[model samples]
Target chain A: MLIGFVWLSLTKAGVPLDFSFLKDFSKRLGDGFWLTVALSLASLACSLLIGVACAAGQSAKILPLRYLCNIYVGLIRGTPLIMQIYLFFYIVGTAWGIENRFAAGVIILSVFEGAYITEIIRGSLLSIEAAQIEAAKAVGFTGRQTVRYVVLPQMVARTLPALTGQFASIIKDSSLLSIIAVTELTQTIREISATNFRLFECYFTLGVLYLCLTLPISFVSKWLERRYDYGN
Target chain B: MEIEFRSLSKQFEDHKDVLLPMDFAGDVHALAVIGPSGGGKSTLLRILGGLIAPTAGQVWIGGEKVCYEGAAVEAHRKKIGYVFQLGGLFKHMSAIDNIVTPLIRVHGFSKEQARARADELLGRFGLLTEANKKPAALSGGQQQRVAIARAISAKPKLLLLDEPTSALDPEYTTEVLGIIRELKEERLDFVIVTHEMGFARHACEKVLFLAEGQLLEYGDSDTIFQQPATYKLRSFLGKLLEWNI
Candidate 1:
């Protein structure tokens, strides 16, 4: 009903609802979509790596590693992602002479998302029954082997949905990369809207572009979650 | 392998006693540890299994002193298999794989050899039909069977069972009892912490009674069951017999 009313209102206002703009914009949006996907997928891997590392360090039996991990998660999660982007692009990028903005964006997103992913994976790890750990230890598995063979498979099962959701938000969050002039989908949409003076059409096309990118990921995540839901 | 605990005691953070100083030095085929809740049965079992370190003293499993040293404890755990009341089966792995992977991974058995051993154990425990099922898919009794199979996959010299039948219904208890009895017949030494009075009476050669972390009565099962020497042991037995447990 809301969509119909909006359509009528726009039509009455004589707004040119021509989707013909997409005919020309499709290729750029397609490239942008892939870039978004690449950013998300690469960061997803890096984020999970960082997450598992942080969790292991935080829960490590050693004292210094535990303290260092606590500080990493605490500091990264404490600050805003936008500020982190600035810190990376302005300070670290200049100091390190890193000319690649894409690498900067991906790294920033990973470090930002890694903190939250650390908490997710850590909580899931703890949620496993203590009896399972005891059983693993009793069966002659070392601390590392138990974490790898016994705990990790189950942790992946528990955190899949949350991890996918975090990745999806990474897609949404990628829009912020426009601030860095990286020519991603949002940046391209803004450029098209400026050139064609078709604000509504361009913005609506961007929304569709994101939905298309994220919807398939949602479906795959749910399927994987069900496949791994053994304890249910 | 004979298991012994000499001056072994466990205390918590507040210096509160969990398991009081206890001593046992002997070899036996199978011994049953019976006690009430918070009586440190599970604590002692865990300490012996090398899963938890006691606050003081030492443990000798098969006559090797068990300290908290990493390599020594690793070797110690390999010799002693353990099972909890809920079976403690890995939920992610199929019942057969739960028993199979450990044999190959920890004990360096070939995959074929591990599968054969797993199949033999599963068949002996009457879990052939449920072998491919995950622990979550199996009934409580079948899960326990898988646990027993997994525990014995490495051919540990001694097995530690913490209330293996405590979580089962009477029917499932019968299934587990059949396997435990079969283990006895095969001459596998084991220590079981159990609440099932009948199984302890019929299956175990020795009975150990612990109350509030103290060993009160322990002897040949037949003698302890027929004649209790201490008031604590006698009262504990009288209450359980009265409840027909």
Candidate 2:
């Protein structure tokens, strides 16, 4: 809504939102864009896996595994994502001699996002009625078979909206990795702005690009929610 | 097929017993488990279905002593099908897919065979037109019929029906009861838990009465209804009869 006013005000100030910088900016941010995309997807995949596992652990029949999952999620959610990222990168990353900063960045983002994802997955799974499980078991499904055939599919439908939010968070949070000199989108924007003195244009362009990346996520999530709603 | 419960009982964590120790042996194929609220009718069916384990004692299905959480129970489970009061058809799957899952996943049928079986059941239950609809799209009668189709697709020897008509209107209840009649004609053995004694009298040959998780009476339809032995059965019948009139 403020876009028209922003364009008008910037032009009036003699620092017009220029398209000439876009060519260079795109070229420079191209690798950074791909890197950001890669990191977001990588983190999402890792977080989903971790979330599913932790959900299983939280609902596990065994007492200890449930408690362990509880502690993991509680600790991750209790602290700030940025603090956790810095802690992971500085402490565990250095201790293990993780020379690859990209790997470290991906790891931290996934670990941070996983806490929220786990809650989503676990809540969805728990929402399933005991009658469903009884029906599955009555049909002679092994515990594993029931989870694979019945529980997981329903869980996907229930968690789609939350999963989409988590994915968007992963993408946005990847911007923070720029603090560690990860050369992701934000870092690229900073480098370009420093050289061209086009801070407003670069930052605005970055916001638009992020919006471009995130809008589809919202659309897809809505589509999935509607598709999977079978009126139960 | 025969079912024998030997000293089977269930106790919750609060040290309160849901099912006191009980023993029952029956040679009949179809047993109607009837009881008042909190009488453990559902629990008894669930225990027999292996959804819950008895705190103590053993359950013998077709002469095999079922060991809870062991291979024996798993083996027993494969031949038993359970239907819940609310259909329990997965909302994500259509009516056909709901039936197909048991045949393909549990009974190890090929995809084509599973589809064929699903179609057959859908037609038999008069749900052929609703095959593509999910549980939400179908009527109550259609949903419960589809659930029954899914349960029986695997050809389980024992089918457990838990409060089968509790949620249905009169027309849907008739439609569901009609399917049960068809199953009986096919000689499929089942234990049905129901409140509608008229339907139970028509569908089941024998009855098992449970109260406070104890077996109050086990008898033929005539004995349970006409010559009820226990005071619980007599009072329950009196209340049901009064309500019916």
Candidate 3:
């Protein structure tokens, strides 16, 4: 295949197909690896909270609250995530004088991913039948009770697969933080390749690391999709 | 319990009224609303169920004005159960979950109690084997049975069924109707909207004929079918009887 030919040619051209760079880079990557995982986990948690909150706000009866949520979601979704990150970092560091790049990355990723997750949650909520809500109301459930007990359980069950897939996407997207010198996996690999001129080995190791993180999530997502598919 | 609809009217913007102004009441075990499609039969049943507000006049439940025009209509709706045309079981839940949801969520029953109640009702409806299955996996008749079991799980005083058998095949229709007939024997009050005159005749104590948002005739099943009061009812019966003839 053409791919095999290219790969072999690249290996022969001193591209360092061996993955020995990963061990060397792992030492240099050091604190950054833990930092990157912490940043991703923190941002993902914030994203879920903000996403669920904004979804509930959007579905509120008050026009002003719903409109505000809509505008927030639109503004976040319309702009590129890279630009949003740069803007947040610049504004927070200069105007607010917040020196922490890690915090800035977490905040930016949360707001960005929150908008996408909000849409997913809202779609799942709306997919529930109107009759079910009516039946709940008929049985004397208050608006809050209906949503908390009746609607939310079904929404969570329906959207779990999509949420897991989104989490995987968020993990991949966390690599973008390297643009701000956050020294994540991608940045560490790039630094290693720049020093030893082992581009293929470094990138290959990075891809494997990403696979290690995302493949498990992908499998879990598929399993959840099968489990939640009440249609079966 | 007695319920009355007094001069109730409802209309959508730029559309003719779906329910014309009319006064009707029921103080019986079972009543059937029978008519051609889009004749406001469902609209009337909805008003009685307190799902939507009427554009004019009021509805009284147990001699209290529970619903009025342009007002928040809050009533003891738990006493009334409405079955939509196609079972309308929650697609996300298994049959037992669907049956137990209203009890646990609305009535604040403990999960153990709700599950016990669901099992009892599913057993009564002969759906214990299918209780773990979702509505989408069940046959039409089984889904409808689950829907009915869900509706009655709250032990409603009044049950309203909107074309419960409309989506089923003849065999399934008979199966579902047989379930309803059995419920009637247990003294459950029902307001059924049906096209099956045969079931109406055999099962309902009274039948009301509706046409173009107006009540055309009301009488016991035999009299309404054999000696229709109006030309509208006569033509309606003629059309329906022709199907059987």
Candidate 2 lands at a TM-score of 0.89
Runs in model 2 deviating more than 4 A are A1-15, A56-69, A88-99
Residue by residue across B164-239, what tens digits does model 3's lDDT show? Answer: 9999999999999999999999999998999999988889989999999998888798999889889988898898
Candidate 3 lDDT, A1-232, residue by residue in tens: 9769978898688564666556655676665566667777898899999999999999999999999999999999999988987888887666898678788788889999999999999999888878778766555566786777668878877889999998888888888988888787777777778888877777767777787888999999999989888772
What is the CAPRI rating of model 2's predicted complex? medium
Please write out the lDDT profile of model 1 over residues B137-201, one tens digit for every residue: 89898888889888888888988889988889999998898888889989999999998878888
**Residue A167 in candidate 3 has what lDDT?**
85
TM-score against native, each model = 0.91, 0.89, 0.90
> Per-residue CA lDDT of candidate 2, range A1-232, in tens?
5978987887788785675878866777888888899999999999899998998899889999999999999999999887887888888888999869899988888888888999998889888888777777777778898889888888888899779877888999999999788999999999999998988878988998898888998888888778777665
Could you tell me how far off, in angstroms, the CA of residue A115 lies in candidate 2 after the best superposition? 1.9
What overall lDDT goes with each candidate model?
0.86, 0.86, 0.83
- Top candidate when judged by DockQ against the true structure: 1
How many Å off is the CA of B209 in candidate 1?
1.0
Q: Tell me which of candidates 2 and 3 scores higher on TM-score.
A: 3
lDDT of 3: 0.83
Write model 2 residue lDDT over B84-164, tens digit each, in one string: 898578777889988887788877899999999999989988889999988888888888999888888888878888988
